[model samples]
Structures are given as structure tokens and as C-alpha cells.
Target chain A: MQERKRTEIATLGEFGLIKHLTEGIELKNESSKYGVGDDAAVLSYPDKQVLVTTDLLMEGVHFDLTYVPLKHLGYKAAIVNISDIYAMNGSPKQMIISVAVSKKFCIEDMEELYAGIQIACEEHNVDIVGGDTSSSLTGLAISITCIGEADKDKVVYRNGAKETDLICVSGDLGAAYMGLQLLEREKAVLRGEKEVQPDFSGKEYLLERQLKPEARKDIIEKLAQMNILPTSMMDISDGLSSELMHICTQSKVGCRVYEEHIPIDYQTAVMAEEFNMNLTTCALNGGEDYELLFTVPISEHEKIAEMEGVKMIGHITKQDLGCALITRDGQEFELKAQGWNALSEKNN
Target chain B: MQERKRTEIATLGEFGLIKHLTEGIELKNESSKYGVGDDAAVLSYPDKQVLVTTDLLMEGVHFDLTYVPLKHLGYKAAIVNISDIYAMNGSPKQMIISVAVSKKFCIEDMEELYAGIQIACEEHNVDIVGGDTSSSLTGLAISITCIGEADKDKVVYRNGAKETDLICVSGDLGAAYMGLQLLEREKAVLRGEKEVQPDFSGKEYLLERQLKPEARKDIIEKLAQMNILPTSMMDISDGLSSELMHICTQSKVGCRVYEEHIPIDYQTAVMAEEFNMNLTTCALNGGEDYELLFTVPISEHEKIAEMEGVKMIGHITKQDLGCALITRDGQEFELKAQGWNALSEKNN
Candidate 1:
């Protein structure tokens, strides 16, 4: 391997590093009045409602740096928050990122991370308004806050799902989780091995799903163009089952999702069969899909059914019915929030 | 001895813990249209400019939990960001907080931290808009984003200082730094001691200054009431010398601050003498003051001079003069940026 040049972060210090990283970052949004080089960034939203969402990603718990690149980590961190904004029927306008890294990281590592963040921002047309960088004692920690804008009447909340609303989900699930499993297995297989590359042929999609998941920005834009405003919506980061339960609990309405309707890619099904894992369970409980889960009025069911990349999986029910999943075998099973909980004993 | 009840955070899970901690949070600001329990918090800033600032505090780096209580840490974290908004001459209206913790922490610990954040929010009339909570691998990490509102023409930036501008700072400095020193010494003295209390009778002010520093909200209000708007402003979190240098550099100007005019509390002076540290150096370079450092036109000097707890320390000069500090004996020394660099070798 060729030796890569390494620059000590201390050579630039805190202020110098911030200046170097944020230099020439021009604001693209009209709402971004002023950015960086100040105590605070100034934004103007004269006629729109501002939406704010934040996420925190910690090392070891949220990610493992052994196989994950710093750039992808940065991209995922920004995408998660941006997804939340889109889930709210809003357009992300600006982002503020805060990162704390240990001494093990070099300036080039941070550059790669920033480059990834910049790519995500450019793709979404969101401006990098401001951020804070500091030293950590152990591993890297990232916290991102996304600011978005929407019309007052266009914003969707989880509590708006009414009875009989059609439940819809964009794209597919289980791929990201399967990708994680594949990476973990490969890491174990390659442990202590020398001069041998792990065979991941034909699993590129799974790896991409796990390493670089995209937010459902297109789905949101399509909904807007179709004049379909979701009664309730949220991004599926904590698995489909967990998010469905949140929507039900918040909306005071239960749901009935059909297992056959849950979309899963061909790769995900094959991987589940190979791993001997339940495909439906993986589709329901696998998290980090970044897909949009939403409910719309029944009157718009035909419109949503015809929308590409979207699946009509369920319908909202009265609260007394309770949330349930109708299995393919004509059995009804109550939905349990078996999603990955960050504070659960398993994570610890 | 009393035994404190400790409950594992895993018992409540991430969602449960967040709901429990933020159960009764009521939005007090009209700008906060919706808060918590959603994909994103909605804010309506119909006519005012929005200000955003963020900070990241890490364990064993930005703070020492060995001596600093979690509640104080939470309070200080919120206040630091709030101070940034005030530095821009804005009124903080909402805050988003994200915390990552390790298995060592319990649910009760999080409650204490939230309680501190609640208290600060209540004091400042800022609403707890939204946040993220997750588990960390090692120590606790906190990131807070404060959003504020300001009139379009009233917002201030660091680059607005012009030649002949009068530099002013609110209240005294170095007390927080002295408090940190006192806490460190006492921690060292009380290490491994059983049931022995550290003697901090007369130094209570310093401890409070360090552990529970308040943002200069009153100073901002006073300036507004006096009809004086700062040409340039920023909080003195990174020491007066460092922050002054930032303003001078950004504004393309130089400054001449008098060392004798720098404010210092009596307790700080006494502590510096006891520690055999330079008092002037502490006043100039000791950070975490949370005080407002601002500059106004020379014509507003008379109004600022009459303002209580506010000191006129210097005047802006032409860019070629360079930033300098005049001693009590009229000796001129170029100002140096000696503020704590989180990425420096000393920190590592």
C-alpha cells in the first residue's frame, strides 16, 4: 500500500481547523442570510414554517469504524436528519453539524468526512450553515440538526392519521439490515487472514444499502407533484414495525398491515433465505432504511396505488382494534416494537 | 448513609426515556408551533430573522464528570449556546439537545440532566423544541443547537466593527476559570478521602461561576433599552483576547485594550495570587466567561460608560496597527490567542 500523507489537526488548532474546513462554503438557499464566521448563522423565513430535526450518532454504538469509511459516516449522519425533514413534508434548507473526534483522526480524515457531507448537501440543495468541532477522548461522535421549510398547511405530523386512512411506504426494507449482517460476517471471516479479500460478489447492492442509504427525497417530491398530502408521515429509521407503532400510538389509531404487501427487494429475500432468517421479520424489524412511511386519505388510495416506488401496505384502524400484522397464512399477529433501541441491553 | 435509587436506562428504552424526560414540556413561545414527539419541531418566524448556533461537549475533554455534576453540565451546555444567540443580539426561542451516554449512566442521571436543561429553558423563556438521545461507547456526549430570533436590522456580526469603535464587555471575567482551578485543586485534595468535605467557603462564587455560569441576557436587554446597538458582538467563551482577535481579524481592523480596564472579580484575583498565576493573564486568557463582548460606535461611548456592570475596555484602530494590549504601566504587548484549543497536543 502507498503511504498517505497525514497532517496533525493541532497544526491548525480549533479556529484554524474550522476556518479551513468551512472556507468557501457558499450558502445556496434564500433562507440562509448569513453562515459561518460568526457566533450564530442568520436565516430568514418570512412566509414559511421552519422545521427543525436533530440526530446524534455515536461510535461503537451507532457504528463500527472497522469497516465503515469516515466519508460514508458523515453522509449518513446528514442524510438521516434530512430524511426527517422530508418525512415532515418539508424541504431541507440548511444543516448544522457538530463533530467530536479523538486524536487518532488526521486532517485528511476530516476532509474526507466533510467532502461526503458536502456531496449530500449539494444533492439536496441544502446549505451548510454552521457547525462545531472539538476533540473527543475516545471515538468520533456526530450530531446534526437540519432546518427545513414548508407551507403552513403542508406540514405533516404523526398525530394526523385518521381512521381508515391508507398506509403507504416508499421503496423497500430489510436490505440495509441484511447488508450489515453481511459485513459483520465478512469481518469475522476475514479476521487474522492475510493477503485475501473477502468474496462479496453479487452482494454489492446489499453493501450499498448498508453503507450508503439514500433518503426518500424522490418519493416526497412525487407526492407533492401528485397533490397527495400525507395525513401522517415519518421516516423509517427504527424499523417498519417500531415506526408503525409510533404512528399508531401518536395518532390514537391502530393499523393493519399485510405481510405480503411489505416490499422487500430480491437481494434481501435471497440473503434472508441464505442466513435462515425470517424474511417478513427482517422486513418489519430491520431499521435504517430511510424510507418514508405515511398515511393518506382513503380517497387518494387510487392515486397512491398508481404511484411508482410506493406500496399500499395497510390501512389505519380505530384505536380499539389495536395494531396488527396480517401474516401470509391468514393469521393476525399484534405488532410489537422490536426495533433496535439504542438504550436497550442488547446495545449495551 | 442513604442509598440513591438507580434504574437502568434500558428499562425505559430510548423512546420511553425521551418521553418520560420530556413529558410535560409546554411550549411558551408563539414561534414554537409544534415541539417534541414529531419528525421535526415546527417554528413560525413570520417577521423575524432566525439565528442558529451549536456546541458539542464531550466527556473527559470539554468536562470532568468526576467533579462537575450532570445537572450543572447540562445547564452550562444550554447557557453556552444561549450566550451565542445573545452575542448576535437575538432572543433565544428554542433549543434542540442531543445526548449520547454509556451504560454506566442510569435513567435517573438523565432526569437530572434534563431537569437542569428545563430550568435553564424556563429561565430564558426558551422552549425545548426537539432532541435525540442515544447510547455511547464510552463517556457522555452532549450537543445543543439554540435557535433565536432577531429584528432584521438589529442583528449583529463579528465583521461589523469599524475603526474608532468602542469595545465593551459585560460583567467580570476570569472568575469561571478560577472556579475551574479551585474545583481541580479541591478534587485533588479530596481524592480517596472518606466523608471529608472540601473547604470552599469564601470561594463559592467561583464555583458557581464555573459550574453554573449564566448567559448575559440582561446585558443584551440593557443595551436594547439604552437604544445602543453593538457594531460587532460575540460571547467571551474563548477568552477575551481570543474573541477580540476574531472580531478584529474579521472586521479588518485592530484594537487596543487596556489590561487595567479588563474586569476581574476579587475572588478571581485572590485565587490567582494563591495559585501563583498571573492575574492579568487570567483575566485576559481565562475562558468560559459567558459574558458579552461587543463593540459600538465611538459616539455611543458615553451611554456604555454609564451602563452598570459594563466596562469600556478598548477602541478599534486601523488594520495596520495590529491587536495590542496596554499594561497598567503603559507597556504595549501584542495580544496572543492563548485560549484553550480542543484539538491541541496539550488537550490530548
Candidate 2:
């Protein structure tokens, strides 16, 4: 490994620090007319509807720095907001990031963070525009706002699902949650609270899933190419069941997803078993998957099922039936959202 | 005050809390196609250039709850971002707010904050399209992203100042800084560390300036009415001197401003004297004024001079001359940007 250079953030001041961090950023989106070095960024989306979304990630609450790398944290932060735009069936164009950090972070730390942000923007073909940098008294706080564009007719909303539509999800679930569990256990062992070394020999995929989740842009593109506009769509951030319930409530319908149809990675299942946890429960309610969950017309079911990386998990039903799940053993049960309740969790 | 009601935020959870706070919000902007209850808000500005800006406010850094009311803090937060749009010669259309609070804040506290945000949106004819709510482990964190629009030809940038342009500023300076000083003094006294009672008898304007600063939307309207477009523009958030240097550096020009002509309120001057601080320094370097600092073509000097709440304090000069402040006694001193250096200050 190369020796890392460190510079204290205080020496650069706010303006100097921002300039240093954003100096190399190049705008890739045509909509972006002006980027950093301005009080505000100028953009134009003359022929498309603009999609806007924001996400806030705070230290000690949303993430644990003890096991999470700063670069991966930054990458995940940007991906989270970009995922929202993709969930709307839009192409992300630009983003502004606001960060408040305490004295504990040095200039090199911010550079590493910005490097991850830059990589995400480059890979997603989005522009890093304007943002604010300040100091916090406690932990680091990151707030990202992403701007995207979509054709007026292509923009999808969560309230548009209809009865009989097919519920589909891109990518597997619960791997990220299992990855987090592994990291936590490893941390405990490192602190001498446990003696076992984490057996992560074949669990690289799980760690990647948790630390560097990507937005399902490919899924969006594939759906567009297939001429399939989802009746309703949202990104699975707060677990599959929670997101499914959101779609059901907004669309005024119910859904029945098959437990057998829930996709889970091999590593995730193995980790869940090793941890003595219910694999089905984790797949249903473990959040941070960053997968696309959508409902499409039943007519397109066969086409969607044939597509790569997509699973037709269920079908929308009448509102009276309520949201439910059909177990692999032919038993039906009502589904409950056990996603991260940030406020209540904090109180506890 | 009447008896206040209290509600625990945990009872509603994150999703319910967001829904409750935004329940009464009505979309007034034509560009806003969707609001809340979605992964992303949809907007369109087919014929206009869009302007985007973001600001992050952290507890104990940008503000102190000890003296700053939650309502006023929210109001000021919204105004600060809106001011950036107006600074770009655009009308704000929509905003997305992301707030993370600890368990210490209840639902009622959030409601008060949202009430202030609603009032600002209502008065400005802007829509609160979307936001994210979550829990923080420490203090409250707020990030507001504002989107606005303007004609392509009418949008202003800071890098357009011409040599010999007339530099103008709306309203007064240093008042916000004075207000902050007063608040700190009162806080110290309240802690019993200082015996003197705060002598804020007739300095209500200063207090208001610090607590509830308004964006200069009226000035933008007035400039439009008079058919005068600034050659360069930006809001005076980081005091006049700092913002002026930015304009000068970006425009590749220099400036000369008369220290005597810089606008300072009587209360601000009196308070500076009371604190034994230099009044001129406060006016030149104290930030958070939320006033517009702009430069118009020299041809419009007479028109701008006659306008209400505007003072022509200086003129742009060739780059060779450098930025300077000419004192009443005819002494010329190079201007320095003593804006809020958050990192260095925190380190100290």
C-alpha cells in the first residue's frame, strides 16, 4: 500500500478547502451550464421534466465509521440520492453535496471522500455542481441533493400502480444487511470483546453489497429499452417489505409477494444461518439494498420475467385484501414493515 | 404565549412525521408536477434556465439553540438558500429540506420548525416539494436545496463584472453580526458567568436581522421594474468584503470601495461601540446579512442611485489596481476577505 499523505483541514479554510476538493470536477451533463465557484449552479432541461431528491447521512446514526471507509461512505451517500432519481425512472444530471465535519477530519480525509464522490459522478455520467462546506461540533454530516431529467411521459410515480400489475425487483435482497452484521461482529472481536476471527473468506460479495451499493441504472435503461414503463416504482432502501407497503398505500392497492420468489445471495443466506437468524425475514425487512422495486402491467410480465437481473415476485391485488406474502409452504401471512424506524430507534 | 402542545416524534416514526409536516403544503409553482410521498419530486422548466443552490446548517456551528428559536432558525435556513437564487437573478420555485434530529427534539419541535418553513414558502410563492426526515445521534442538522428559474439571457453570474461597473448593495450590513453578538452576550449573562443584563432596549432591528433575515426578493423585483440587470451579482452572506473579492476574482477585475459609504445601521454602529469593536471592520467582514451585492453597468449609475434601499459604495477597477478600501481620511488599505472560516475557527 502507498503511504498516505495527510493535511489538516483548518489550514485551507472553508473557501480554500472547497476549491481544492472541487478543482478537478468536470461537468458531464449538458444541462449543467455553470458548476462550482458560483453562489448557485445554472442548469437547463428544456425538453425534460426535472427530478429532485435529497438524502441526509449523519455519523454514528446512519453509519459507523469504525468499520466503514470514508471513501465508501461518500460513494454510498451519493448513490443513495441517485437511487431516488432512478426510482423515478429519470437520468441523474447533477448533484450538490453539503458536508459539515468536526476537527477530527483532515484535508486528506475530505479528499478521499470527494474522490469517491467523483468516481460515482463519473460512472453515473452526472455533474458535480455547487455545494456548501462547513464545520460541525460533533460528527460529520453529509446532505446530497441530486437533480435528474426524464421525458414527461416517462416519469413514474409511486401512486400510479394498478390492480393486477406485476411486482418486480431488480437484484437480490438482504446481502447488505448481512454484510453489516459481519462488520459489527468483526469490530467486536477486534476490540477483545469476542475471540472468534470473522470467517469472511467467501463473503466478499456481501461486504461489497453493504459498503459500495450501486443504483440500478442498468435496470432502468433495460426497462426503457423494453418499452416498459412501471405503473409505480421506488428504490428499496428501507427493506423490501417496507417499500412494498409504501407502493401499496400510495397506489391504493394491495400486493401478495411469494416468499419463495424473494431472491437472496448465497453468502447472505449462509451468513444469516451462521448468525442464527431467519433468512426469509432478513430478505423481507433488511434495508439498504438500493434495488429497484416496481410494478408493471401484467401484459408485460412474460417479457420482464425473461429479462436479466429481474424477479417477478408478486402481483398487485385489491386494497381490501391488504399486503401479504405467500410462504414457500403454501401458507399465507400479512406482511409487516420492520424497516429502520430512525426516530423510534433513536429514542430506544 | 398560549399553552403549547407537545407530541413525541417517535410516535409518528420517520415516514409519518414527514407526512404530517408536509400535509398542509400546497404546490403553487407550475414547474412542480409532484410533491412529497415519492422517491423524487418532479418539476419542469421547458423554456427557462434552472438555478440550484444548497445550504447546510448544523447545530452549534451555524446557529445556537440557546438563543435562536426553532421557528426562526427554520425561517432563516430557508431564506438563506432562497437568497442564493435571487442572487442569480432568478425566482425560486421549489425547495427540498432534509433534517436529522436527535431524540431530544419532539414532534412539536419539528412542527414549529416546519411552520416557519411553511411561512417562508408561502410568502415567497415557492413550494416545499419534498424532504427527508431521519434521526441523528447528536444535534439537529438541516439541509435545504432550492430550485429556481430565469430566462437564459437574464440569468446572472458572478463572473460578469466589467471594469468601471458600479458596485451597489441593498439595505445595511453588520446588523446580523451585531445581533449575534447580543445573543452571545445574553447567553453568557443567563449562565451567570456575566452579571450585566443585556441592554437590548432599542436594538430590535439587530436582533431581527440575526434571527429572521429575509431574502432580497423585493430588490430583485424592483430591479426588474426599472429594467436594470446587474452585470454581476451575488448575495452578501459572507459579508461585503468577502463576496466582493469573489466577484472580483471570478470576473478578473479589481474594485475600490469607500469605507465611509458602506451601509451600516445606527444600531449596528452603536452596538459595535458598546462592544469596543471596530464598526467598519464589522460592516466589512460580518456575515449572514442575506442582502444582495451586485454591480451594474456604469450607465445605470444614476438610476440605481435613486432606487430605494440601495447604496453605490464603489466601482470595479482594472485587475492591476487590486481591491482596495479608501478611508474617509484618504488612506487606502487593501481589502481582505475575513469571511466565516469554519474550520480554522473550530480548530481554535
Reference contacts preserved by each model: 0.89, 0.85
Error of 1 at A150 (Å): 0.6
Q: Candidate 1 lDDT, tens digit per residue, A312-343?
A: 99999999999999998999999999997888
What's model 1's TM-score?
0.99
Candidate 2 per-residue lDDT, tens place, B270-304, comes to 99999999999999999999999999999998899
User: For residues B23-90, could you state the per-residue lDDT of candidate 1 as single tens digits?
Assistant: 89899999999999999999999999999999989999999998999899899999999999999999
**TM accuracy, model 2:** 0.98
TM-score of chain B of each: 0.99, 0.97
- Screening candidate 2 with a backbone cut-off below 3 angstroms (N, C-alpha, C), the clashing residue pairs are none
* Maximum-lDDT candidate: 1
